[model samples]
Target: MEARMPDPVAGPITEKSDHPRTEGDPQEDGDTPRRVVLADPRSYCAGVERAIEIVERLLRDRPGPIYVRKQIVHNSHVVADLESRGAEFVDELDEVPTGSTVVFSAHGVSPAVRAAAEQRRLEVVDATCPLVTKVHAEARRFTARGDTVVLIGHADHEEVEGTLGEAPETTVLVETPQDVARLEVADPEKVSYLTQTTLAVDETREVIEALRARFPALRGPGSEDICYATTNRQDAVAAVAQEADVVLVVGSANSSNSVRLTELAQRLGTPAHLVDSARDIDPDWVVGARTVAVTAGASAPPWLVEEVIDALADLGPAIVSEHSVATEDVLFALPREVREV
Candidate 1:
């Protein structure tokens, strides 16, 4: 199913002016007034940016419709924009005609998928984020060394599915600490672990700890598999959540990092909700909440964040300011097929 996206250029919704409140209004609750603190480093990260660009570049240079398998990134606004610009998103290789070009989403694909593309003689552009590609390679390496690759990630996510396919027979998907407890492996002494890049930092840490307790000789990657963008966004939200009464994470439900942002805020004891856009906000959520923190998933665009702020400001004379700092220089290059075309 497709996600709903508002007009990208529209202004905030306003039904009526902010009217004077009655005695039972929030002002009588002895809570703080309305304000918004935006989390910096909140929107489009390097990997997501590169993936979108790959499709945009292809659409500009190629003829007819450029087929992309799955949403290039999880944000509906992004997919909608690309679709308007002549990109068609499909579910699988069979949906794409033989000899037609197909671009893999940032969420990688399996060897079998590659073979299918080869058989179809379809021109392929690999837009799989380098970070995700690293995890898949680690899985293969662990399997080659005769170790059971214990993957810590969501079982149903596209990225996890691709990583598991790399070493399906040897890799066991562990979604929770409980999963680790119930895990069965061929050899206890020979085991390794990798993680989905978009998992909650605290969640993954607990899972890893559980894994280590079970497998004393468990080998981890030289670097953590959780992508830098995911960690940074979660860190920003955690810091902001402490000072806010409510938090709003703007992203599609399928966006893993987006869901993690909301969970992190809730874990910090703040009321948080994941939303597709500012239109999804509930007025009751902000009642008696002095301050609200705003953040977007890495795949989300800045425009959606602004819309939330606009809606909040319309709710009252809300004061808005940024509460975090981010210096991001990381970037991934576009796939070669699009570049050479």
Candidate 2:
């Protein structure tokens, strides 16, 4: 079956549950009524909340030309809004004026980037998610104990770079079980592993098993490296994807967690698409799909989810239903600068 395409226009931001319906009551349609199920634990994870708060606070309290090292989060809407509010985003410290205020993206940064920022005397505000910070701490602990640390994550991701910096000489990046098999460690007894917070749970497990099979002494983190948010969102998608004819994941192409959601849905044998808004949706794919499931990534704004729902409602009457695989109430505290004040 062909996949549904996302709408091409940018959609409005709103809470996931606040989707607006068409003019009349949805039940009035004479055709066979199809149901639209929304994933309950779909949007805004705690880490994303903290990151956004950091940017919002910086904008409110600090002066113009505030520089951010990378996209604060993966969503273009969030980045565009920050840019409009006078935040400047750059790939490196040199792009930022010396001694200017700079906030690191939530994806975190390598030690090299941090050193460069310090050399430039940039006033730094670290907006790295606390969960990602946990991975970094794990890398340090393993290295301090004379262990070779295997980091299971996308090698080029900013978060992976930052975590790798904690113990670069001792760290090895593994994206698949194949990578694990070829890994060269100093000693089987002195190896530990950590993961990027936003990795797919099942995929990570396969890699972890591969490492364990190669080295029985391999150590794992006290808790899983994949954060609660990533796990929960994927679980929610998996729960509903089986019942729906099509699945729509609200997220950007570059969003790690969002891409994982789309992958999970497709793995369940349902057609899935990752879109930023309703404009990205291709009506052709949904033409015959009777039931559709909608979800959003952690960094995705709820508004985009609602816009997709609104667009779908315009095509025909939609009986919205809510489905949740798990309940999440996790909340991360704001940075010291924001909380203390």
Candidate 3:
């Protein structure tokens, strides 16, 4: 069945449930039908697919080790699969031999990193998501205008780091409303803000509101900084969370978007867990849960979600239904270097 469009006027974000499930045993529950509701927009957004395909094309067409800086898309499974195909994951450009071909991760790199790669004379295949690239451009643009750029995101995230590197002297990182209260700009009248593409939409809105209250003349990106995939997945998961007894998000812990989905569900008053795969699902989390909503982070592969559904079925007779907030038809073109490949 097709998914209905998300409620445009969905209620404001709610606080986490006061009564969270603490302890339980799946086996202890009496005979009950278990239904798994899968979030339709879950798994592999256009940018992630594009990033992985870039590496796959490089491995298939290029010779020697295809060095990739950082986890290609933040999923261990995707990185492992690419590694099995002979892709070398490196922490920095220095790790790659000079003149070797290297691909940057989907998270855009800092100008400093780009300078480092250029210094090493490495053949570069940039896989940074176009959406992230947009933020980087905004950071540079705002700073060039003499506006202090307040980046709303986790301080240590690769995406944030890269954007900060755009204008380190002028860009400051703020993760919450309180951070905005403590922020001191050289000229509050000349302040602008940009956000990490993978941040939670509702929470980011609050942070932006805080910034506005502090700097009434503040400016923002021409468009929303949060990518469409992040917003769609969050909407789908929030809808499913309303009906689900427990919510399971599939993705690595370090995946910001994936973590946001789990956090969104929890905020909507459902017990949620972030799982890398079926193996990570704790039985206690779903022991008494009659309806489990399953969702994968944008970086997670589709097969992993299927595996999780199968594992849940193994626990008992199960019926699965998909709760989609919207259908995603977004596609990004491959980088020019590997486009012909």
Candidate 4:
């Protein structure tokens, strides 16, 4: 079957005007409608940018059938586009022919997985986000100090797996405050903590507090482990959710960061939905909503946001607005192989 591609780029859906609503000529009723608000820090993050760059460079320089260890990022559209361009995604190195070029996903990989790829002699390209790499380093540091490390993240995520591998025997995964309560340590005094870079900030805080209560001497990262991109996007969503009648998050269902955005909106007491693209938007939910907030996950492309806005425009004469909470300038460099090629 042919792979799917992202929606073709349409021109910018948002107008540059600062006005909340452009004058729509004098209405007979003498009332101007409110505009839809878009979150500024909504789209791709540095890690995601680097991941896509790796695939693009591979397609340009490498021959046919380059293997990727997992979804290049988390977006189906990105995976499909890369697959259409001759990239093959496999879950295991065993699936990749020996000596073939294979790129790792943005979510880092375990040492065992790396050893397996090395055993196969695959030409590997590491696309793990630098921020994730920092977490892996912290895990190793904690382990070296004879500390029982606690990892705050989803158990099965690729990034968590990789970080855990750095200190498997000592690392414990905690998803909630309850998990922290249930945790038993060989020595409470020697415990430290790290976390997945894309978790919900508020949820992670509660878990951290739980851990701190149990292990008074517990040390942690100088800053929160949740990445700036995740925090910023959530903050932007929350800013608009305060006023939006309904909120829509653009991303794949399996995407962790995307799911968090939807949950954040709902937690703020607003109805929110996660849609892979414009096609997933339900007209019924949006029909009566005077205001809607649209944001995208880190892996999601900005074009998807434009597509959703275009679809909303068809439903009614919509005015688009933007609310920017913060600016992000973080950038990650491509793997050496990709750069050299």
Best candidate, lDDT-wise?
3
What lDDT does model 3 reach? Answer: 0.88
| True-vs-predicted CA distance for residue 139, candidate 1, Å | 0.9
TM-score of each: 0.90, 0.91, 0.92, 0.91
Candidate 4, run of 10 with poorest lDDT: 1-10
Rank by TM-score (best first) = 3, 4, 2, 1
Kindly report which residue stretches of model 3 are placed more than 4 angstroms away from their true locations once superposed: 1-32
61-167 per-residue lDDT for model 1 (tens digits): 87867999999999999999999998999999999998888999999998989999999999898999999999989998999999999999987899998998998
lDDT of every predicted structure (CA atoms): 0.85, 0.83, 0.88, 0.85
TM-score of candidate 4 to 2 decimals: 0.91
What is the C-alpha lDDT profile of model 4 across 1-341, one tens digit per residue? 12222222222235446434434343233344535789878889988989888888888887867899988799999999988888999998999998998999999998999999999999888988888988998999999999999999998888998999988999999999999899999999999999999899899999999999999999998866788888888888888898899999999987899999999999999999999999998988776677888999999999998888877766665688777777667766677787888
Question: 2 or 3: which has the higher lDDT?
Answer: 3
Candidate 1, pairs of clashing residues? none
Report clashes for each candidate as comma-separated counts: 0, 13, 0, 0
Poorest 10 consecutive residues of model 3 by lDDT? 15-24
Q: What overall lDDT, based on C-alpha atoms, would model 4 receive against the true structure?
A: 0.85
Summed over model 1, clashes come to 0
Q: Per-residue alpha-carbon lDDT of model 2 for 216-335, expressed as tens digits?
A: 999989987788778878877887887899999999888999999999999889999999888999987677778888999999998888888888887776767777656566667777
